[model samples]
Target: MKGKIIFFSVFFLLTTGAISAQAKNAPRSIISTTALIRKYHDQKELSGMQKGELLELYIERIKVLVKTLPYIALVTKPGVTMADLGIPDDSEHKKSLENQALGTSTFLDTTVDFQRKMMPYSDKANLIAAILFYEGTLKSLHEFNELNEM
Candidate 1:
């Protein structure tokens, strides 16, 4: 009985160690931009168009980011160029992340006017909450990406 118990305990310990090692070195999964907009963020207070445009801009970024994340993880240099990402040109990518901060949608002026109406109390709070959650997820993924070298 004592010998059997010893054998099982050693087996269990080895299995646990293997599992821990695999977890520590696991590849991190990044969230899709569409899910981040629809499922993750709380945009109930935002107008439908406002919500859609916000989602659209991030979706565009995500598409490019998904392709470039490996390259991004490999390099720490600022302003990752088209050559780095193996793109014909990065104008489209540059344009996507740009107009967002400026609130100018190049797709449709009617869809998104560069209007900055004051947000209501609840909307402001909710927007901040959603952004924090999204930011946290991105930060985690970025940290994991950086950890590959270490």
Candidate 2:
């Protein structure tokens, strides 16, 4: 009986430690397009921030949709396009762009809402970190877009 209890206690401790480690290393919460816009206004490089926020928001949104949408088989099939994510490809890229923008905006709004709710409980540093990350992500995306365009 004593041996069993010791084994169980050790197993519990190891499992809890592993869970704690994973939780700590998990990626930060997703950033939204609106949050990116706010960050852009807060910083001098508006375009860079805008791009980063948009890309990150899109990727995260895609991940969620892929998980929840049953009909989205191509999501994991590889070599998918915006159309796979419900963006229609037609004459002009306008429609696709619009859909992307709307999706990103919605994602950002959700993030902002969550941030506001946690404001009273979370540390200021966490909020700041989140903002910085969003801005940084936008900056990187902007650079990549510029390169592709060039």
Candidate 3:
């Protein structure tokens, strides 16, 4: 009886440890951008570094998912340059996109007449984080509008 109890106890301990290790090593499921923003929004306060870290994580996931995103067809006639469509040159566009990825661009955060609303965060990191949430909300709204229009 004593030997059987010892064996069962050891077996239980080993199984529990293995289960815990597996849980610790498990990869977290990816949630939607809006859901991520909502998770952060629920927090009462987040330091600039924390916000920046979240933004970096968000950007990394976006980079990973780029290949899976829908393609935008850019059809143009012969001899038509990007400038004809008011699009900046390659270098300028690259810089602009980089700023956008960093969530520091004012152009996209403005109204039709370029009227800008002040963001809550004054620090760059916090501002970038706030912009991440703002952009996510805007993207969701645009998608919703498109579906309704269709």
Candidate 4:
């Protein structure tokens, strides 16, 4: 009985410690686009490295968004084919998109790893602003495409 009691106590302590550690290391929540824009306006001029990081984030996000173009068309427009979105129905195009997705996935992994390493406050605002800008641009493009189709 004493052995079983000691084992449970040890397990409980280990689990609690692990939980607390994970809580401490949890990723920060994503800030809103509005807040990011506000912060971006207040930021000082970015250094070359910061500009490079921002550009990388923007390009990676655009690649991912492009990968979703076909699916977005299918859902938003009934009976729409890939050709309607100017996406080739051939295997080569499919393979190219798949390859792009894999590359984008790798870029995202490295980005998340960097963020986990505690990126600088200045870099974070620039990164977030780039993300918001690209996302908004894609949204606007999608809307424009829809209007043109009508």
lDDT against the true structure, per candidate, is: 0.46, 0.47, 0.43, 0.54
Better of 3 and 4 by TM-score: 4
What tens-digit string does per-residue lDDT give for candidate 4 at 20-122? Answer: 9997654321111111122232124433335556655555555545444444434333244446556656777656645655665686577656654544444
Q: What is the C-alpha RMSD of each candidate to the true structure, in Å?
A: 16.1, 18.1, 16.5, 12.6
Poorly placed runs, candidate 4 (over 4 Å): 1-90, 118-120, 123-135
Worst 10 residues of 2 by lDDT: 29-38
| Rank order (by TM-score, best first) | 4, 2, 1, 3
Tens digits of per-residue lDDT, candidate 2, 9-86, equal 999999999999997654322222212232243433333444435444433433433222332232322234455456
Which candidate's TM-score is highest? 4
TM-score of each: 0.29, 0.33, 0.25, 0.34
Best by lDDT: 4
The reply for model 1, stretches above 4 Å from the true place, is 1-78, 86-118, 147-150
Question: Backbone clash tally for model 1?
Answer: 0
* lDDT of model 2, residue 3: 100
lDDT, candidate 3, 20-125, per-residue tens: 9997654322211222223333223434346445445444434323311321132111233345546655676646544544442232233212212232234555
Q: Candidates sorted by lDDT, descending order?
A: 4, 2, 1, 3
Pairs of colliding residues, candidate 3: none
Give the count of colliding residue pairs in each prediction: 0, 4, 0, 0
Clashing pairs in 1: none
Model 2 Cα displacement at 133 (Å)? 1.3
Model 4: lDDT equals 0.54
Better of 3 and 4 by lDDT: 4
